[model samples]
Target: MTTLQGSAVFSACAQHRHRLDRWWSDEPRALVCAANPSRTDALRPDPTMCRLAALVRHRPGLGGFVLVNVEDRIATDPADLRRWLETADPAAVEVARRDNLARIRALAATAPLRIVAWGTLVPPGPHRDRVIAALSADGRHDLFAFGLTEAGVPVHPLARGPSRVPLGAPLVLWRAADEPS
Candidate 1:
C-alpha cells in the first residue's frame, strides 16, 4: 500500500476522513471508537466527529453506530459523552469496558462492522489472550491502541515519530550548523 506524509494538520484531516467512511450511516458499520488523550483534544471533538458525521449526512450509507470509549479510563460516563458525539451524524454509544469479552459479545449483534478500540493498552497479561480471542471471533471489529514510547513520547502506529516538541522561535530558528564563525 502507498503511504502519504504531510503536516500534522493534514494528517488529522486525513484521519478524520478515513474514520468518517467507517462510522457514517451510509455504510452502517459498527465502530469501537477511542482516542489517545495526548493525540486528541477531547474538549474539541466537534471537528473530529463532524468529519466522520458528514460522510453519513452527505453519503447514502447504511449505519451510524459506534461504541465509544476512552483510553485507560473506564469510568467515563455515557451521558457525559454527548459532547463528544455532537455532530450532524450522531452515533450510538456502548457501555464502557471493564472486560474485553463483554465488549466483543456486545458487538456480535452488530456484525459486518468495523471495531475501533483506540488508545488503550493491553500488555502481556492474563486478560490479553481473552481480549485477542474476543476480537478474533468477530471479523468486523478493527481493534487499535495507542501508547507512549520509552522516552515518554506519545505515539500511534499510524503516525510518525518521535513526536515533535513545541519550541519557541528564538530557539527553534537557531541553526549552529549554518552559522559561519
Candidate 2:
C-alpha cells in the first residue's frame, strides 16, 4: 500500500506550503478534514489532531485520519483569523481553496473517509461553500461529519469530547440552513 509519508500525496501538499497548512500520516485509512493551523511553526500534529486520531480509532473501518485546514497560515487568534480570511484578497483565498480541494480530493481518493470538520469558525461564503461541496461530491469516497454544536455547527475535533459519537452523513454545511429545524 502506498503510504502518505514520502509519497506524492505529501509532496502535493508540501508544494502549497506557501498558501495553506497541511498534515497527514503514512496510514492509508485516513480521514481528511479542515481546520485553521495552530499558532506555531512546527510541522507535527497538534493537540486537536491528536484528539481526532483518538476519536477515529473508536469507529469501525477507521484506523486513523489526517488533518488539513482551509487556511494554511497559523492563526494566532482564530476568530480574527477567520475575519481576515473572509476579507483578504478574494483571488488569493480562491486559489488556496482550490488547492486545498485538490489536495483533499487526492487524499480522499485513497482514504476510507473524509470529514467536514471546519466548524462554524469558517465563515459561510462561496469559496467555503464550494470546498465543502467538492469534498462530498465524489461518490467513490465515504464522507462523514461529527455531531453539531449547540449552534448547529459541526464540532471541531478539539472542541468535541473524546466519546465516539456516531458520525453523521456527509453534509453540505451551508445548505443545512434550509433543512427544517
Candidate 3:
C-alpha cells in the first residue's frame, strides 16, 4: 500500500459551536461519525480523534477518516454537550444541519459505507434522530461500527485504547437507539 498525506483544515463558526468540516489525513477512508466536536481542529487531535487515528492506522484496508459529529456543538464534557444539544437555537440547528448531509456525502466520496464511532457519548433524542433520519433516507450509505458500547451505541475509539478496540475486530452493523420520533 502506498502512504498518502492529507492536509488538515480548520474553520471557525460565528457561534463558535458548529464546525463545517476538518481534515486529519490526506487519505480519508470515509467518515468517522462522532458525538460532537471537541477542541480538535487543524492544529491537533483531541483524545477521541487521536484514538481513532491510531486505530485506523493499524486497521488493514482502512486508511484515514474525516470526523463528523451528530451534534455540531463543541464541548469538552459530554454532559454539557447533551444539555447544549437539547437547548441550542432551533434556527441554528436547522442551519447547521442544512448542509450536513451534503457534507457527509461529499466526504464519503466513493466509499460504500461509513463507520459510526460516536459511541454512547451522544445522547439519544431528536437531535441524534434527526441527523440519523436525514442521512438514512435518500442515498444514505451503509453504517458500520467497530463494536457496540455497553449502552449499545457504536464503540468510541476514545472509550478505550486500540488494544481494547482491536483492529482485527470486524465492523458490525449499527442502528440508532429507539426514541420517540
The lDDT of each candidate is 0.33, 0.54, 0.60
Q: Where does candidate 2 stray beyond 4 Å?
A: 1-27, 39-45, 86-88, 138-142, 160-181
lDDT of 1 by residue, 101-133 (tens): 565455544544333333223233444444444
**Per-candidate TM-score against the hidden true structure:** 0.35, 0.63, 0.72
Ranking by lDDT: 3, 2, 1
List residue ranges in candidate 1 displaced over 4 A: 1-23, 33-62, 68-100, 116-120, 138-158, 162-181
Q: What is the C-alpha lDDT profile of model 3 across 1-181, one tens digit per residue? A: 4443343433465233333333334443656677767766655656676666666665545556667777665677888875865798878767766666556555555553467787776667765666665444433555668788666678887666532577557777775333223
On lDDT, the stronger of 1 and 2 is: 2
lDDT of 2 at 49: 52
The RMSD (Cα, Å) of candidate 2 is 6.3
Residue pairs whose backbone atoms clash in candidate 2: 20-72, 21-72
User: What ranking emerges by TM-score with the best candidate at the front?
Assistant: 3, 2, 1
Query: Any runs in candidate 3 off by more than 4 Å, and if so which?
Result: 1-11, 14-28, 133-140, 160-164, 175-181
